[model samples]
Target: MNAHTKGKARSTRVKEGMTVKVVRGQHKGKQAKVSEVNTKKSTVYLEGIEATRRDGQKAPIPIHTSNLFVEAQK
Candidate 1:
């Protein structure tokens, strides 16, 4: 990140379709394509990587950028 005069943080450049793998949590080693990226929330949704909701439906869990390692570019 470049120095900012106003001290505003830089937004992540991650985009959809990039392949990434979880590296620091229980989901570690799991790899998938990035389905969505919420830069405002600093989270990412991975394709086929989801958690079961209370209603029995699969929901995409928000994985923080710090936990992911990009394997392929978009």
Candidate 2:
């Protein structure tokens, strides 16, 4: 299969702009709007949910789609 076909086949239920609750990890129990979806990595990025760098900059963290549940739609 080609890269595009593989990516389409692995599409996640979660979509951008949807509110999702973290099911596992340090951020568990927190709810945030989905900001981005990395289908190839099977991960999703949520707004206001990220890691702080030592320099005080917030870095976007990619959480596995399996670790989040759709709480609401945009």
lDDT of 2 by residue, 1-74 (tens): 78686765333478889999998999999999989999999999999988989999999899999888777777
Off by over 4 Å in 1: 1-12
How far in Å is the alpha carbon of 46 misplaced in model 1? 0.2
* Window of ten residues with lowest summed lDDT in model 2: 3-12
TM-score for every candidate vs. truth? 0.79, 0.78
Q: How many backbone clashes does candidate 2 have?
A: 0
* CA error at residue 10 for candidate 1, angstroms: 14
Q: Considering every candidate listed, which one attains the maximal TM-score? A: 1
In model 2, the Cα lDDT at residue 25 comes to 96
